[model samples]
Target: MYETKKWKSKFFIVAFGQAISLLGSHGVQFALIWWLAEKTSSPLMLGISGLVAYLPMTLFSPVAGIAADRLNRKIICIVSDLSMGILAAVYAGLLFFFDLPVWTVFIMLCARGIGNTFQQPAIQSIIPQLVPSDQLVKTNGWMQLMNAGSFFLGPVIGASLYAAFPMSVVLISDIIGAALASAALAVVKVPELEKHQLEQEPIARQLKEGFTVFQADSKLFYLVLGEALCMFFYAPLSSFYPLMTSDYFNLSAMYGSAVELAFALGMMISSLMFSSVLKIKRKIRTSFIGLFGMGISAAVCGLIPPTYWGWFFFAAACVCLGASGNIHSIPLTAYIQETVAPERMGRAFSVLTLISSVTMPVGLLAASPVAEKVGVNVWFFLSGAIMIIITSILIWYSKMKRRHP
Candidate 1:
């Protein structure tokens, strides 16, 4: 049997610091959103800022992952946190001293994204080392629970802070949180892989070695491709949601926020359930089932007419979306962690992020004009239809049919 006491303490220390750090990050994110709304009041400007913030994560995750493998993983995590802390300080100081342009804010977000690209792979790769194999899923479930709580509360707290204080002060919270997280991580020791040192090979050859793991495991390969396809539908649909509310349901800011909160509630509820009550032995089967539920939810959103109950219908849809997201994501992540060699985890995850990033933007760009002509509801329906199709395909795949976690 595993020594529960030793690893349990390690996991909690890591999780505690991350929970605090994530809350602060979420607060800053929502503060920025409200700030932009007040200044430019243009959805276009907000969208552009989001794109800049996201691009680096897509572009550099693989490079970051490679670094995670090759370097001291604990140091990578600490450095990433400290890097963000420094950035937050600089930006907060700038806000205090002078009037900053909106473009500058975008640049700030881009830098943060770069830092997260490095941090994410390192963090995910280290988890296996901190906990026993039997407890990895439970640990991840708790992390997911923390994320859901942050999402539920972040915007409300952010908007309150924005109303009460200067932007500089709001940013200081993030800086402090990052500093604390880094301090906590500084004491933890992470094991380094020998394969990382076996790198007498060229950089290109090393990168190819990362890809070879997936080639050797065809089932994992197909699962990842299927996930990418699912995200193609999901990412655009998420981007389109706010507009869908305003145009179709005629929801005001209050209602929009309510719908979002309802979604968070679903994620929170599902996460708690997963953490305590649910035991998913058949992870692959669970994924398809959750996806089918998500698709049905999306289609229901489209089918609801513009009437008194439309807002209620939209809110319910958001709950379903949230429920589906948590259920689908948790198992999928556990599967990746359980399946891949620890040495290759960073590179594999980076590739997954890269694939998701590529398809989401494509879907976003493709849908706007189409939404203008065919109406947004068509896209919603289409999103649902595509997910159902993917689910069907996965179920029919004999390999997937035979698979379990």
Candidate 2:
């Protein structure tokens, strides 16, 4: 049995802080996208903003990972949160005083991405320190629940705030969320790992070490590749889903919120199930299964009739997609924590983030043009098919490796 009392308090505190932060950040993100859409009515602009927001994660993840590995992870988390808060405040000022130009939003997104590059790896690294090995899955489940809750609440709150007050209010809320997260990190005491005595290395050398560790493990390498591919296709769904629901499905913005809420509900339900009852002996296989399910859900969602029933079907699909995807993700995360040396965990996760983020912009960029040339329905169909093919290939490859070995 794991020692619950020793670490549970810290775990809950950190989790609560993250939940609060996510709620605010996600709320602001949705509002920003809606504002852009209302202003420009351009999918291309939204895609570009999404690309800018994520590009930093691709560019800086390796370096961020190295810093997380070499420096104090707790300090990294705190500083990143504070920086994000300051940046959000800047955005609030821009929205309040100046005309909210597209370029300004893009720049702010880039700044936010920089903060994320540091925070993502640091938070993942810190989780292992806070919880026992056996509880990793449960902890991840709770994390997912928080994520789902944020998704569920953020858009609703954002829409309400945008309706009642100005965009500045939403931005101010985001700043507060970041400030609270930083404060939470300050209060918590994260135990540190013994520093590894490596020869003092150049920045490039340290960055290269992250890549080397990832490459040395074939299973992890392929897993990262799979994750990247999934993100490549799925990332655009965020940009497209709103447009699709409003344009294609002829639903209101409320419908978009409904779809998001449905997806989050699915994730929450699955996260609960995983935390309580689900167990997978082989992490890789479980991941493969989850990927397969996600693909199927996407495909089915695409086939749903574009009517009221369509919305219901889409909601169902979101639930399946979110749940199965989370189920797969939790085990993979736990496996990584178990397999990677503690010293290298931050870098390894950063490398994972780097790979995942690199291809996402390409996916988002591709989404609009593809939808323009083909139809939105066709785009959905193609995305589902590609997802299925990729998941199938990974599953086959893993099975073949096992058989041959």
Candidate 3:
């Protein structure tokens, strides 16, 4: 319908606005986490909070994907943002009126998660339509940059707002952001998917068709599984990073900021490199390189003790993990965009999100207790070992089959 220049221009407009909204949403997320931590002081409650936020996405993302394919994605995205804004407003109003329990906040977060469920697949499905195939990797890398930028700045802003203002105010800020996002999306012209009779089939059957694409390309299936394994190994390491930084390395709470900053900086650097320098043709091989780098850095971080140079080593590992991770994810995403049939992309991406998460919840549930028993440092080392082992197997298998993310 349009040339690369036109689509690219529209893409930037949408992306820029979405990035602004993302920053606000992330800020509110951290604010709520900090608020819950301050109020509950119960690890059990905090853990439950995490579960409530993520589980809905895992459960309903496929359904959301189905809806995205069936419905107008532009409308879906706008409605998602506006709905979140309304919910945030109402929730904030309730908090202002009376002393709402922690359960209320958790429930609201679950709603936010559901909003994300619809929004994420819709956006992913929309991206390929917005950019030329050759530019997918560059665009994906830029998206990663926006995410990393939000991650780096959101918490700081959220913490500051939380400290200076009330919870209601922080929530209201999220609403403003949501409104801005919706307004931006409201203007973008998204090309519609042409409908087919098969799409009108039963939901269960439609979903089955989605899964059947992987059978058509077993390499894609294997690629998704390999990434799933990476995500699984990453769970314990990510969840317990603060604990390891504080307890294992004798770093202060503030020191965790430096570690996170290092990761963000790495992501930014990788994003820039991907956009310019890294023309990653062997996308699968690039992902493997990243996996190996991540595994080695994580292992080294775990093995190092709290000596004078401990912080330096830990910071370096975090940077490597973050940079390599961006390198890993960009091409895989671009590969999916390039490879999958346009008609089935929504389901394909949703399935990837779904199957790639098979172990993460399990990992999250098990990590705390495992770390307690084995020591947090030990947990990191174990995750790194798992990563390395899995990557090695994948590499050998790929070589044997001459298959490729």
Highest TM-score scorer: 2
Which lDDT tens digits does candidate 3 get at residues 124-185?
Answer: 87888778898989988888887778767766777678778888889877898889888887
Per-model TM-score on C-alpha atoms: 0.87, 0.95, 0.90
Q: In order, what lDDT does every prediction score?
A: 0.74, 0.80, 0.76
Clashing pairs in 3: none
Model 1, range 1-405, lDDT digits (tens) per residue? 234667777777787787778878877886776566457544455556656776887788778878877777788888888899899999999999998886788888889988888888788888887777766667788878877787777656666677789999999878987988887777766555666454566777666655776777755565566667877776666545555656567665445456667787888888888778788887766766776778878777777777658779778888898888888777777777887777778777777667666666666666656666676678788888887888778667836545643
How far does residue 133 in candidate 1 sit from its true spot (Å)?
1.0
* Candidate 2 residue lDDT tens string, 128-215: 8888988888888888888888878988888778777888778987888888888877888888778676427777777777777768
For candidate 1, which ten residues in a row score worst on lDDT?
41-50
RMSD of each: 3.3, 2.0, 2.8
True lDDT of residue 367, candidate 3: 66
Q: What is the lDDT of residue 172 in candidate 1?
A: 84
Cα lDDT of candidate 2 equals 0.80
